[model samples]
Every structure is written in C-alpha cells, then in structure tokens.
Target: MPPYKEGRERMKRKHSVWMMILVALMAVSLIGCGTTQSNLENKDTAKPAGKITIGFSVSTLNNPFFVTLKDGADKAAKAAGADLVVVDAGDNTAKQISDIEDLIQKKVSVLLINPTDSAAVVSAVESANKANIPVITVDRASNGGKVVSHIASDNVKGGSMAADYILKTLGDKGNIVELQGIAGTSAARDRGQGFHNVVDGKAGVKVVASQPADFDRAKGLKVMENILQGNKNIQAVFAHNDEMALGALSAIQAAGKNNILVVGFDATDDAVKAVKDGKMAATVAQKPDLIGKTALETALKVAKGEKVAASIPVELQLITK
Candidate 1:
C-alpha cells in the first residue's frame, strides 16, 4: 500500500469520529431544553403543590353571633395550615354578592357564605356554581342555589320550643306580641312559622301583634313601644333574635310591666347574660362557633373530593333562667 493513501484514510476516519461527537452533544442540548419548556408549561397550568385556599363571605361582623362564627373558622384554618380569606358584607345583600364575585375571581378552592337574605343571595351562589367552586352555606341559606352543604340549627324546632315555653309558663292563656327578625330570611320565616305552629291553634294564646324589627335591637324597642300603645294587655313577647328581644324588654321595663315573659332566639352572650339575670325569659341556643368549625371541616373534605351530607344540623337548646 502507498504511504499517502494510508495517511488519507486516517484523516477521513478522524473527521467522521468528530462529526459523530458533535451530533451527540447537539442532541443532549436539545433534550435538556425540551424538558425545561415542558416544566414551564406545567407550572403555568396547575397550582403549586399542596396549596389550598378557602374564601369566606360573611353576612355581618357587627353581630356578635357572626363574629364568633368567623373566629371559629379562622381557628380551624390555622390549625389545618390552610389559608382563609374573609370578606364582610355588613348585612347588605348587594355587598355580599359583590364580595362573592371577588372571591371567585381569586380562584379559591372553596367558598363559604352566610347569606344576609336567603332569596337575594341566589345569584351570588349561582355565580360561584358557574365558576366550578363548591359553596357551603353557614347559619343562613340561599333560597335558590345549588349548595354543597348547609350548616345550621333547626329554626322551626327552636321556634316551636319558644312557643311551648310561653304556653307552659302562662298556662296557654296570654296575649303575646311577637317582635320578628328581618322579613324573608330563612331564620326569620322559619322561626315565625314555628311560633305560629304552636300558638295559632291554642284557644287562649293569642298573637295580638306581630311586627318586624329588622332584627335590630333599637328597632325592637321602638316597635314594642308602638305595640304597647295599642295593646296594653299583652302578657308575653317573643322576639325572633336576642337583639330584638332585649329591645322589647327595654320597652316593657320602661312601660313598668314586670310580669310579661320575653322569649328570644340565638342565645348570644348578651342574651345568655340576660337570661341568667332573669331580665329575659328564654332564648334558643345555636352554637355559632360549632357551626363555623363544622363548616370549615366540611369544606376541607369537599375540596379533597370527599362526600358530605347535604344538610348538617348543629344541636339546639333553650336557655332559660
């Protein structure tokens, strides 16, 4: 063989080997780039791992009952290492709807609503539903929405208990004035119905006057005063909530009537104190804190794809002195 031909063969072999090495390096670089791009796409589409957020749209923080409820939710969220974003509606139905919309925009994993007005909050609930957000109603329920769960006491039973207390105390012979809560609310409607169920049929128990005080303490006093002007022979008063009952008590005390029994609902701190002091007759106990805690636990279960009951009822009892 010729020396020149051998040298040419060696150079060709070296060139081929270098070309192969370059091609392998380029393939490695392309594979690395593809992996990074795929990760970026996944990150953009899905949430970060182990992040769960819950939104709570409360009716009003001003009311002590609702304030306690919020505190319970906050406590549970902290215990579970979850995030809770709360918005207060101040008892305004429109504000509550707007608040819920904002929560949906935030893309919360779950939504908890304590509706100010059961009928008016339907649209807000439907909006959450359309967003594919699960909704759990606390304390108060929406009249026309698909709710994942509703957590509240049996208002009708509470009302019936109130009426029974009155009848038993007065021997079913008394002229009673009812100071009602806000009209159209489930609590108001159910409580009033329960009261009527027991009182309407009694021969001697008469509902001489029943008026709505909007669940305001001051309004309760004013309305009772007006009722007193016309019905001076009233023997008992039933207020839908503690606020109104306390108000009516004030009016009754001012009117120098000490024998009239006053029954109320929602045994709040104030109402309980009143009952202890014998200032008020009786009030139904609805544990708002338990309701809040149960609601949070249910939301966690639901967010994790667990099934929960459609209605969760907390225990209720009558508080009397």
Candidate 2:
C-alpha cells in the first residue's frame, strides 16, 4: 500500500471517531433538557399553591361529644389534603382566647372554633377579622363581631322539644328539679327557658329545686344529692347535658329513689345506653360530627372568598325509650 493513501485513510478514521463523540455529547444534552422539563411539569401539576392549613380551637376535648366533633373535622381535613392544627381550651375562656391568638400568629388559612363562652370569643373573632383570616364558629357562637359562619343546632328548639317530652312523660303533673349547664352558656339559658315555657302554666307541675351543675357529672351528683336532702318529693330531674343527668342518676340511686324520671340533653353514647336501660327517661341528641364537618366546609368556603351564612342550623334527635 502507498504511504500517502494510508495516512489519508488514518485521518478519515480519526474524523469519523470525533463525529461520533460529538453526536453522543449532543444526545446527552438533549436527554438532560428533557428530564429538566419533565420535572418542571410534574412540580407544576403536583402543587397548586401548596396545601392549606386550618386551625381548630375547641372548648374542651375532655368531653366525648367534643372529641367526636374533632374527629369529624380531622377526617374531612385529611380528605381535602389540608393540614389541621387542633387546640383544646380546657373549658377556659381565657385559654381559648390565647389559642386563637396563637393561630392568628401562625397565619393559619382559616379558623374553626368551638368557644367556651360566646361573649368571651368576640374579641378573638375581631382580631382574626382584622388579620383577614376567616373564622367559623362550631357548636357555639361569638357574642359580637364578624364571623364567617356559625354551625350549630337550634338550641331554643331543642330545649322546647325536651320540655315537651318531659311534660308528656310526667302527665303534666309532677315536682321537678333542673340541673343546668355552664352558667353563661347559651345551651343552659335556652334550654332552661324552653323547660320553663312548657311547665310554667301546667297545674301540679312544680319546680322544686334548680341549680347549675356546670355540665359536670360529679357536680350534678353533688347538687342533686343536696336537693334530695331537702326535697324528697321531687318527681323528675331535667339536666342540661347527659353528664349531669348521669350524675343525677347516681344521686337518685344513692337516695333509694327509683321512681324519679330523668331527662337529659346531648344524647352521648352513655346517655343512649342509660336511656336503653331505663336509667334515663329521655335525651336530646345533637350531631357533633355534622357540626364539625359543616364548620370546616364553611371555613374553607370563606377562606376562598365565598359568602357564607351567619348561621348553619343542624338537626336534633329526640332519644327516648
């Protein structure tokens, strides 16, 4: 073979190798660009302004009813892929106020509250309003100020229902005692009014004793025991909540009085069982789960700049044997 021809062939081979390397480099760059674009598209699709956070302030998680309410809210929040931060006020109005302040500082997207006291929560609501955060009241109300919505049962009507049941069961003639809830609570006031409305003019139906039990079973028991010591002829006891009614039951049993009828509100599981066993005459059932779900939904709507009604009324169930 000739030397020049051999050298030209070698040069051609080198050029071919270089061309191959260049093509490989271009292919690698194109693949990298495609991967980057894919990642960008995935990010855009996965996050639509990220997730929302909701703050839930409950009056007391100590009660089974409130626990149910919280559970419902948590389930709904999880389904919506939203974050929920729950705080318990321990039935303290001051602590509830502080909890609301903390939620505001955290800059939560929305606020769901079950106030300890409606009047005491107004300041917190106003503060949230000033910060442009929507507030939804659940199972309670704020005394004054702007609240996006209130999700609760009609206490007045529930009270009336309870009163009617008591009257019918007693045959419109009996000596009764009233175990009220928390002093300042709307439930206590409204329910008491309802009972009074039904029993006021009825002949032979007398209110022998009345006292605030603070919606605590132990308190109710103590109050009832004291009343029984003074008035042995009490024919019935109406309690603002099941806890109080159960307490009254204990007191009545201790006094060896099995004839007195007991009516309660907030038909908790225990209350239902009591009714089933004939330990309680009747109970008014409030749907805590529905209240929680509705409050969260309303809060979301308000957060999204939608108009929500001031009050969302829930249904009541009359539970009796």
Candidate 3:
C-alpha cells in the first residue's frame, strides 16, 4: 500500500475512538440524573415533617356529655389545622392507660385525657411526660403526674349551689338520698365534699343513703330504685352529675312520687330540657363544648413551648324551670 493511504486510515480510526468515549460519558450522566430525580420524588411523598398532631383520651362516649365534648374537640382541631386522635376508654381505667400508651407511641404533639379513674391514670401521664409530650387534662384530673394545664368547671361551688337549693326546698330538714359519681374521680370527690360540707352541718337534715352509680344513667336508675325500697320518707335527691340525676328522676317517677326535689350537675342538653319541662328541679350548667375547644387551643400553645395557666376554670350556673 501507498504511505499516504495508510496515514489517512490511521486518522480515521483515531476519530472513531474519540466519538465512542464521548457517547459513553453521555449515557452515564443520563443515568445519574434519573436516579437523583427518583430519590427526590420519594422524599416529597413521604410523611411530612413538623405536622402538629393531638391525642384525646376520653373516659367514655356512652353519655351525651362526652359526645358533646368530643364534637367540640373535633371542630377545634379542624379549625386549627391540626390532626386529632381520640380514644374512648369506655369508663374503664385500664383501657384508658393502654390507649394513652398507644397514642404516645404514635408520637403525638400533645395529649388530652378525661380519666375514668383519677388515681389509676397517673402512670399513663408519666409515660407521655417521658415521651416529651405535654398533657392537658379535661373534665377529670389525675391524682398524680405532671400536667401542663387543667380545664374544668368549679365543681365544688356548683355542688354547694345544688345542696343549698335542696336545703331551701326541703326546709333544711329532710331525708335525702345522695347519688354519687365514679369513685376516686376529682369531680365526684369534690362535688361530694362540697355537698356534705353544707348538708352535714345541718342538724335536722339526714343523709338516708349514699351510693356510687359510676355517673351512669342506668346504674343510677338501679341504685335509686334499691334506695327507694329501703327509704320511704326521702324528701330529696342530689346527684353528682345529670346522668345520675336523670336516673334518680326515673326512679322517683316509677315509684309515683312527684314531690321529691331532684337536683343535678353538668346541665347537658337533655338535663336542660328536663329542667325546662319540670322533670328535674335544677342542674348546674357546665359548658363541655367550650372546655373541649379551649383544651385543644391550649394544647397547641403548649406544643409551641408557650406558658399556660395551671388551671383554666370555665363558668358555671344553675338552670331551673
């Protein structure tokens, strides 16, 4: 072959090799870009950071009061753009403790508890405390634990008013059957103390029977029925809550007794209506909806590391026909 032809062929081969190298570099760059794009999309779709979540543990929703309370909390959470997790303990303390633990594992930003039994719920509160979640108790309080805030009505004052009304109606001297709430709860204890503080001092007045109905309407009915069997001269009834009061009212009606004055606390819708209808003598009004809404708002503030009042007392009043 000629020398010129051989030189030209070598130059052509060198050009092909350079072109192949450039093509390989371009392919690797395209693959790297695709991998980075996929990773970014996965990160975006994953759980969002810094989203506020609240947990509410209720004693029970069997009664209308707690149902109304939960409704208020739901509305407040929706308004504040926070996620809420509500657990019902069915008026059982052990169940409540477990529910709280599950909520803590979920990493909630705050916890709101309406304890079934005050003394039994302390360990649940402590666990949440260890998880670094602030706790706000509503309606009922824990006997022991660290709580950021407590929101409820002044039960002692309300109880006093109920007792005074009974005293005036019964002429300060009569046999009264007291229907109490769940034992060991703050509401039951405080309300009972306030009532006895007034009634116990009256020499002519006598407490014929005192029993716990667990703040349940059916239990109240049965207990009152049994009390009526043993005491025929009972002049009045004072229940710690409206559910029990309403239950006691049922017993009174069933026994064909109309003159017995019945008073109750927590003026729920049904209780208010009964008061209006002359079925109940009186009831202390408690704004459960306000309590629920306020609790959630306070929890949000607490999650932001803001200081809140130790006790936030809602207003109370007596409702009568």
What CA root-mean-square deviation does each model show from the true structure? 6.2, 7.1, 4.3
- Across 1-321, the per-residue lDDT of candidate 3 in tens digits comes to 799999999999999999999999999999999999999999987656667899999999998889888889889999988898999999988999999999999989999999998899999999998999899999888888899999998888888989999999878899998999999999999899889989996989999999999899999999999999999999999999999999999999999998898999988998999999998999998888998998989999998889999999989888989
- So what's the TM-score on candidate 1? 0.85
> Clash totals for all models, in order?
0, 0, 0
Total clashing pairs in model 3: 0
All candidates' TM-scores?
0.85, 0.83, 0.87
Candidate 2 per-residue lDDT over residues 157-196, each given as its tens digit: 8878887888888888889999998877777787898888
Q: How close is candidate 3 to the true structure, as a TM-score?
A: 0.87
Better candidate by lDDT, 2 or 3 = 3
Question: Which candidate ranks first by TM-score, i.e. highest?
Answer: 3
Q: Identify the superior model by TM-score, candidate 1 or candidate 3.
A: 3
Q: What's the lDDT for candidate 1?
A: 0.92
- Tens digit per residue, CA lDDT, model 1, 1-321: 699999999999999999999999999999999999999999898866887899999989888888999999999989988889999999898999999999999999999999999999999999999999999999888898799999999999999999999999999898999888888788999999999999997998789999999888999999999999999899899998988999999999999998899998888899999999999999999888988999999999999999999999999999999
